[model samples]
Target chain A: MSIRQIIDWAIEDSRSQMTGTIVSPFYEYSDYGGHWVWACDVDLGENLGVLRCVPVAANNRELIYAEQGRAVTLSRLNNGKWVITGLAKSLNSTVHYIFMSFTDDTYQVLRKQLRGYIIRPLTYGELGTLVVPYGYGVLPYGAQGKFDAEGNFLEIVETY
Target chain B: MRNISAALENIILGGGTRRPDYKVYAWDPAEATISEVVSANGILDDPAPVDLTPYVSDVSWSDRQLTFALVDPAGLFHPDFGELRHCLKDGAILRLLEGDETVPEVDWAITFTGQVHGQIGWKQSRSTGQITSRLTVFGRGETQAYKRRKITSQEYTVGTDIGIALYDICKTFLGLTGKEMRIPFTLGRQFKHKTNQLAQVTPWDGVCSLLKVVCYQPFFDGEGKLSYVNKSLHRPAARLFEDGDRIKELEVPECSQDTVNKVTVTFLDSQLERVDGPYQKLGQAQVTTGFFSMHETLETWWSEDRKQRADGTSMKVIKSVNSGILPVGSEHYTQLDEFHGQIEVEISVWVPILATVMIAEYLAAAFIPDDVIVLGFGASEGITIPVGRIIQAQAMIGILLIMMSIGSAQYEVWGTPYDFAYLEKKSVAVEDGLDYWLENNLDIKNDFIGTHDQADIIAMTELSWQKCLSMPRKVSVADDPRLEVGDIIGLPDGRKLVISALSKNIKRGEIPTLLIEGCKVLTA
Candidate 1:
C-alpha cells in the first residue's frame, strides 16, 4: 500500500492502542469530565504519531466549536496550547490523533473530556504556576500580549 | 512645572487646527532645537506597550528611543506631512501630546520626548487605504558621533572657569557651532591638559570627563541644547509630577556597582621634546605613547622629587609616543658638535627615555656593577648612573653595549633628559607626584580629581543614585498629549518616577508603553 493509504487505513480502523489524558487547566489527571482520552499511533519515524480523541462538553454546557488541524494560532488565545500528542474532531465526532512536533494552527480548539478544557500557551509570568507535561513548553510570554474582549489568554504553540 | 520648548510648541501647535496627534522630533545639529521635518501629528494610535524597554540603566551606550506606528493617508498631498527624513535624522527629538487641541494648555503637556534614530516604514490602512509611516527617534545622548576631528591645540588648560574652555571645545572642535552651549557659570575647577591624543575619542568624551571632574550630569534638554547642571550650584528641571496621573511602581534593590566613590582623570603634559639620533635614519627613531608612566619612572630615579605641568598640574605624561621621522644627509649637520660632547642612540620603544634608562640598568646590573642597587627597574636609569660622561669609554661602552644588543631588541637613545629639556623648555618627569590613587585600594582609584577630595563623595553619590533609584516600570497611557517622556508622574501613594521612554502608535489611539524610571529623589 502507498504511505498515504496506509495512514488512512490505520486512522479509519480506529485501532487505538495507547491512551493518556489531555493536559488541561480545569481537569485532574483522572477525571473524565474535561479530560480527553487520546490514542496516538507512532509512525515509522521516532516520536512521530497521530493523536485521536473525542470532543465532549466541559460540565456539559457551552457549545463545542472548533476545527483542529496541524497548526492553529490565534493572537488572543496566547496562554495555553496542548502539544496535542491529532487532528481535531467536531462536537459530533471523535477526534483522531496524529502526532508531530507542537505546531501552531489557527485558534479553533475547545476539547473536553469530563471536567475542564485543555488550552494553549499560558500568559507571561503565569508559567511558574502551571503544571507542565514532560515534553510540553509554553510560548508567547510578555506583558504586551493581546487578548480578546472576554480576557481569554492568547497563545502560540511551538517546540522550543 | 517646566514649560515646553518653543520650537517644539510651534510645530505641534502650528500644524493645523489640531495639535499633532503624536510627534517624533529629532534634535537639530545646527540649532539647539527639534526639527520641523520629522515632527508630524498624524492621527495618533494606541502605541503597543510591548516594544518599550521597562527601564534602561545603560542608556549611555544605547539609544534612548521613541518608536511608534502611525497612519499617514494623505501622504505628500497634505501640507502637514513634510519631508520627515530631516525630522527623523540622527539628533531629532520627539514630543507627544494627548489632546487634538487647536490652542493647547500647559496642563495638556507633552507626554513623550526623545531623539530620532531609525525607521521601519509605510503601511496603508485597509479601509481608507491611506499609507502611514512607522518612525523611531532617539534622545540627545546619541549626539556623540565617534568621528575623529583634530583638536588644533594639543593642550587646553582649564583656569578658574572651565566652562569657557568647555563651550569653546564643544562649539569649535566638535563642530557644534550653531548649537546652543549651556555651561556652568561658577568658576572653581583647575582641570589642566585634558587628553585629546586618543584615537577615535570624540570631543564629547572630553565634555563628559570635564563634567565628571566638576560632579555634574551632562544631558541635552528638550530644546536640543547641550547643557550640564551642577545641581548643588544650579537649579534642576522643575518638579512636574502631580496627582491624577496613574502610575505603577516596582521597587528595585540597590546596585552598588554602578556608583563610584572616587575618580581620577589622567592626561598627558602639553610639553614637547625632540630626540637626537646618531644617524638621521627614520628607522633609528624612537616612539613614545601617552600610556608610559613618567611620574612612576621619575619618582623611582629622583626620590622625593616632584614635577609639575606648566599650568601647575601634576605630571601625567608617562612618555610621548614619538612617530616623527628624521631625513638622511641632515643627520651629520643636525649632529651638534659631532664626536665630542655626547653621543645618542635610538630605540623602537614607545618611551625612548625609559628605553635609555632600562638599557643602562640592564647592562650595569648584568655585566659590571657589584654594589649598585637599581630601584623600580631602574626608574633613575638615565639619571647620572655611570656618573655623567666621566671620560669617553664609560659612556661609549654603554652606547656600544646598546648597539651590540640591537639584534636582541631595539633602542633609540638621545643625549639625556637634561639635553632634551635644555633644547625645549620642558620639565623632567622624575616621578608622578600625585600618588593619591596609589595610596587607596588598588581598585578604588578616582578618575575625576575634584577641587578638594570631593571627587570621592561625588562618585559615591552618583553610584547611589544609579543603584537605588533606577527601578523602572512600564505602563500604557491611553491618550492626552500633555505628557512627555521626561515628565514626572506621581503615583497615588505619592511616589515619583521619571519617564525614560514613551512610545505612541499614532494610528492606534492609545500610548502602548511608558518606561518610567524610579526617581526617588524628587528634584526641584
Candidate 2:
C-alpha cells in the first residue's frame, strides 16, 4: 500500500493552523495510475494560483490562471502520490509555473539535510529548486514567485 | 454509603476527567457464561457501540425491576425479524456495570443483576427512524416465580428449626444454590407442634410464614442474593444529607387517614389440652315409607374428623330414630306383615369445624306379602315404616341401622393435619395511642401464631410500623448507585428514614437522577 496518503494526511494536519497562501509543489507527475497530478500553489492576494500541466507525451507545457481566488489542499488515492485541488475553481491550462523541491526518495533524503531550499529533478529530467512563492510584485504575503534567467527561483530568506 | 471507591465518587462529583459510562452483560446462570449485551466500548469484535438510553431501574423493598432500550439499527436484538436475532433464555441474568473508560472493567461497580422478565421486545420510531429493542429484567430473588409456585404438601414437626426449613425450601423449591442465599443459623423461632404444621402455600407465602414467626422479612440484597433480616434491629444510619447537599428536591407527605391506630391480633392458644363440645350432636334426619324403605338427611354443625378426635376414639355414627308407631304385642300368628324391600338414600353437607366431611349410610330389608293387612296404622297402600307402622303383609318389621366410614382432608394421607382438634382461643392485642390515634383498626389472623404472647408481640410490632407508615417522605437527588432499599438515612430536617423505594434513570451525556421514597423510623 502507498504511504503517500499518510504523508498527505500528515501535511494536511500540519497545515491546519496555517492561514497564508501555501505555495505547494507545482511539478506535474504521473501517479502509479495513468492520472496526471496538478500544481496547487496559489497567491493569497486578489489573484489566484496558475494551473499548469505537462503531459509525458506532449512536448509543450500548458498553463491557465484560476478564474477567482482559491484555496488548495493535497489529496491522494491508493493508486499514487498526491493531487493538488482548488477549492471551488477550474483553472485547467498550460504554462511553466513554480514548484516545490520535495518528492519521493529525493525529498526524503533532502529533509534530513540543512533546512533550506534544495534543487531536485523534475518529471521531464529538468533541474528545479523549491521556491517559497512569497513577496512577489503587487502581492504581499502571497505565494507567487518569478524565476531567474536559468529558470531557477531565488532562495527565500528565513526570518526565523 | 454503598461502599463505592474514591475514583468513582470523584467521577460522579465532576472532579475526574474520565466520563461515566455503563455496560450491560447477559449472563447465563445455567452455563455460568457471560456475553456482552451492550457496553460503552461496544463488543470485542464489533466496534459499533450499542445505544443504552431511556434506562430506568426501580428498586423497592419487595421488588427490583430494570428497563432499558438498545437502539438496534442492524436488528441484532430483534427476536422475530433479524439476521442475528437474540432470543434471551429464561433466567438469563443481566448484569449492569457503572464505570468510566479510564477504569478497568473488573473495577466497575455492578449496580444491578437481574433475570430477564419476559418483557423484551422491539419497536421502530416513525419520526427518528430508530429501531430499539426494549428489555425488562427482574431481580432473581424478587422474581414472581416464587410467589407463583406453590410448595409441595409437607409437614414440620414441633421444634423444627425455621432457618433450616427455609433453607430446604429455597434450595429444593426455588432451585437456589447455597451461594445465592444468606440464611441465618436460627431464626429464633420453632414450630410449637400443638397444631400440626402444614405447608400448603406458595413459596413466597411459605417463606413469609416461617419468617414472620420470628419477626423477619425476606429481601434480595444489592448483590442479588436472598437475605432474611429483622427490620426491628437498630442499624446505624448510612448517611446524613442537609438542605444544600446535592439534594434536588425534598417533600414530606402528611400522615394518611387510613393509618392504623390500633392493631388486634387473634389466634388459637396451642398450649391448652384439647376439649370436646357438649356431647357434640353430630346430625339427625327422618324417613318414612310404605314399601319398607325410607330416606332423609341430617345437617351437621361440625365436620367429623376420623383420624384425630377430641375424645380419642375413631369417629362413630351414633343416632336414634323413632318409627312413630306402637309395637303390637302379638304372637307369631298375628304379627304385622313383614315388608320385603330395600332402602336407598344419599346425604350431602358441609362441615366447618374439621374442614372435612363425614358420611354414614344404612341399608335394611324385610320379606312380607302385600296381600294381607291386619295392622292398625296407616292404610295398606301407604304403609309407613321407620316413622310409621309397615302393614305390607301379616308380619311387622323393624328397621336395622348400619354404619360406614367418614371422609377427611385431601392431605390426610400425607400426615399433615388440616384441622385442629381443639376449639380456637381468640387472643387480641390493641395499641391505640392518643398522640397518633385515628380509630382505624387492623385485625390480623395468622394460623402460625399459637400463644397470646406471640400474638401480642406481632400486634405491637405491626403497630409500631403502622404508626410511622403514615409519614411518608420523598427526595430527589443526583444519582448514586450505592443507595439501596432498607437503608436508614438522615434527612435535612434531621429525621431518620428507612428507604422503602427508589427509582433511577440513566442516559448518556446526562447526569442520572434518583427519586427515593421512605418512611420515618420511630425511635424506641
Which candidate should be chosen as best, given lDDT against the real structure?
Answer: 2
lDDT of 1 by residue, B173-211 (tens): 654443344455544666542332222346667666656
- The DockQ of each candidate is 0.01, 0.00
Q: At residue B239, give the lDDT of candidate 1.
A: 41
Candidate 2, B313-404: lDDT as tens digits? 11222222222232211111111111111112322222111112111111211333334434566555553344211432212122211111
Each candidate: RMSD to true structure? 32.8, 45.8
Give the residue spans of candidate 1 off by over 4 A.
A1-160, B4-63, B70-120, B123-132, B144-154, B158-160, B177-179, B185-188, B192-200, B229-452, B469-515, B522-524
TM-score of 2: 0.49
- In Å, residue B56's CA in model 1 sits off its true spot by 27
